[model samples]
Target: MRVSLCVLLPFVFFAQTAQYTKDIEVVKVGVIFFNNELELVRAFDTAIRDINELELDVRLEPLKHFVSEDDSLTLQEFACELIDNGVAAIFGPSAKASSDIVEVICNTTGIPHLQFDWHEENFYIHTRNHKLTVNVAPAENMLATAFLDILHMKQLDWKSFTIVYENSRSLGRMELIFGWRQVHKAGIKLWHFNRGDDYRILWKLVSSTREKNVVLDCPADIITEVLNASIYYNMTGQFNQWFLTSLDTHTSTIRSLNSRQFIAKMVAVRVRAYMPPPVHDEADVF
Candidate 1:
């Protein structure tokens, strides 16, 4: 009886510990940024601190590794480990492709994910909708609208548009639907739309673009393809600079971008205020 009580006592202690730990709905955060660069790392960390204020139970655990072409598998593995460790929610990896991987893991694990700006098909569902994914930032549709607004504001009356996209994931297709709506919003028209590799089609559209402009939503590696094509056709100056979406600002890609090679363009980006926890009310749990 004495040995039985001793063994039973440890089991009881373990149960109490697990139950206590599970009571809180941890708003777990996961991010994929250029971890080696202090600027990107610090900025990302500070953003999470602000998020902690919104929910008393929220916590952030940065996936230490960054995402690059070579490191994607590593990052994916680390993220799964985080999910296994009982993360209740996820955030960051703001681009569509990377976020899709996270979305799949969260769905499989029965955890909720909140991708910030980029929304993939069936991944983002609003909190009000009672779905697993949420997006706090503007959607790609909103991003396309912003670019169209820029054209209208500048009163660039080119009637034709060219869309460059990738379908490695479904994000490009989703954006195409929204981009057309943006064109309609500007009272303009869309021309040749191209998707996934093979930039030959774009040269054919340059004559049309000689009168208008084009929109490019290619990923980092593929952005160079459009840049080369625009230069090849000597249509670089024919239209407004190609527009892109904000994605992982990795070092190698930044170094690869030469202003002389491709005309400078603006991407859909956000200026977020990164604040730490409230020191003023540190004593109050509420």
Candidate 2:
């Protein structure tokens, strides 16, 4: 099912308006997304249309700015421009550096910053007083705890496993699992792979070790490629189990991969319900 953005609009609007004058009839919301995030942009636009169809009392005007993922200066400029245009809240530019820049801008201006992507830092722990930022994704510690709970419930805690992560941010999601391993003295192996790196080498090493349990964490976009590598290495059989930590594991591409034989042993955990994008009918769409 496609998830409507209307469900979130009321809370955001009410929260933002509470801090300002309630006499306003129209609210301007700023959205900053990278040029590559067309799916996110489409989803946001769909949500806005859905909200408008409701004919609510307060009209929402979206001020969207598309910037290069790596352009920090442009991101800052657009964010400032949105603020100057009187946007009540800003969302997106999920890249870590860009998000940080927009977050600081929002914090300084007392504007709400809403994020829907995974982030390594926990503001509640690191910046206790930063109240202007809101993250829709699950916190890293909470996600780790859920992973631990799944391990226990599935009776996989006693078994040795390998953690295959794509980057430092993905590794950070496993921090609590690492602590659990230390306390329990469990056999856990760590393997890191860069985005474009060959996964055969990592899978070869894992296969040689005879590891049956695997925890895979990476950006959603490359997950299917990573799993296809595992399949090539004969790691998706009945004896092997895979756990995915990406919330977007349910995307159509991954779902198609999972439909093939021998992938039933794979499992995924997500805090938020999977909402198919409005353009899900299109192949490989996220």
Candidate 3:
């Protein structure tokens, strides 16, 4: 329904120092993102128009970059830059660990920071820091709720359902595992967070397990692998529903695959809160 996130600064330090606001000419909102999200980055930069539209006095300044789970040092190195640069407001450090790192930096430096909802738990862990923090969109529950709607739509029995997920350093990996458990604890036949094994070899479990419906929290690479395996292993016909995590953008994912075949199989968390209007160009944040 409704949720709020505020980017906050530490009170203890601020109490001793002069109010940090006077020196800055305009509020600067810093964003950190992945290299692959170039188009999405550009969409974020279109805030030139968003600023024009919202009429807010301050505007956003994105500091975008690529981060992998393996690159914690690089992430922390950049986190220090945001801290040293005195970013008046920082919007993101992107990944959970990177976001966590930035949250610590913000806590230490008393910088106000906000990240788009990856999950409420993510918000919960950092909200304690007392920085003005908010979740701009529905997190875990949005997917689980949409799934519950689909079950009702299909007239599907709850006992036939199961979920598969991967815990490979991605956001919605085990993030949704907890949400799924909390939301649907009963009549759930089975649940798993697929280890990053070669999926095709391990997927005898899919063929052997409850075959009626399966929902997954896997990325596009894993999803594509599982789909190919299902088609190859002859385990797909009985499925009434399948869920794909929002690990990849819909348009980009569609560009590579047969749109018609995937049309019914894909689901994603489409967050449109900051979207201004249909007329503006979308690639400015990159």
Candidate 4:
């Protein structure tokens, strides 16, 4: 699960080997990301060390820019600064709106912009001309296909399931699933719920529905809350089955639900493993 990454942050250096032992070129790259996700920063740091050890002709000099979720102006300002400094590429501003602004700058400036996130909208798939934007996240179409395969593997009649999702991102995933209905042959029902303190209303609707098959596409925290409500509403029983869209479900432990030994069929998607970029030693570079 601890995969090395370079796509999350903008790394815009040419991958060329040095012509001679004396030639050394250090290319500057900019990484714009949220202040949170310190874990990603730490993981990227290790990736940097590995890259540096490669001793490629074009060494990477990373310039990090951290921004808040609400500050669109600051995100633009950071992109401007990175451009002014002649950075080869710009990495993030992980929020969708901010990322749009950053991508415009990258395209206009002819710099490659790398991004990593669950791209449900297909915004980062490709461009008509510049092709500057790149997303490292798995494509929504691929994920949709994988889910269908999972359903078939389980030999479950998942065609009549209800989709319980949280927020716009989850809805986007739901759309991906529905868009591929010709292949899946599933008549899916959708329910959208915002993240909040109370899930009683949502639970009531879910419990009242005749469909015992449920597909959940939400954050881990929201998943926990929904499962709690499912139990309270007496919705977890022999006739029901829950299919989780999140890869991290196996890692999640709902003690209350587990203690009751609710035996309704349950299954989850496993997260896709990420591979780090390849690194080469000085000799290999030449």
Top candidate, metric TM-score: 2
Model 1: lowest-lDDT 10 consecutive positions: 1-10
lDDT of 1 by residue, 1-286 (tens): 1111122222333344445776644434455554444554565556545444543432444454466644567667866877766654555454524435666666667766655444554433433332555555555566555555644444434445545445434344344445444554553334443446457666656545452355555545556555566565655552355545434323115445465645534333223333456743222221
Better of 1 and 3 by TM-score: 3
- Evaluate all candidate structures by whole-model CA lDDT and list the values in order: 0.48, 0.72, 0.50, 0.67
lDDT of 1 at 212: 35
Q: Which lDDT tens digits does candidate 2 get at residues 1-286?
A: 1123323844556545645765777788888878887778788788877776664456778899888877888998998999999987887767455447787788888998877766667656438434677776667778877777777754344467888887766766677777767622457888888888888888888888777889888877888887888776778887788888877677637765754555536767644445577834212222
Give the per-residue lDDT digits (tens) of candidate 4, residues 1-286: 1225443333323563235433658777788778886756776667766777874666778899888877888988999999899887776655344346787778888888876556446443345433787766656767777776666653575657788877656554455556645422346777778778478788788777676888877766457777877776666788888888875565466444765547677777654434344653211210
Per-residue lDDT of 30-78 in model 3, one digit per residue for the tens?
6666556555456555643444354333334445556665567877787
TM-score of 4: 0.74
Candidate 1 accuracy as lDDT: 0.48
Model 4 residue 19 CA deviation (Å) reads 7.7
Question: What are the C-alpha RMSDs, in order, of all predicted structures?
Answer: 13.3, 6.0, 8.2, 7.4
Ranking by TM-score: 2, 4, 3, 1
TM-score each candidate. Answer: 0.47, 0.82, 0.61, 0.74
Candidate 2, superposed: residue stretches over 4 Å from native: 1-12, 15-23, 122-129, 155-158, 182-186, 258-264, 273-286
The collision pairs in model 1 are none
Error of 4 at 210 (Å): 4.2
- Number of clashes found in candidate 1: 0
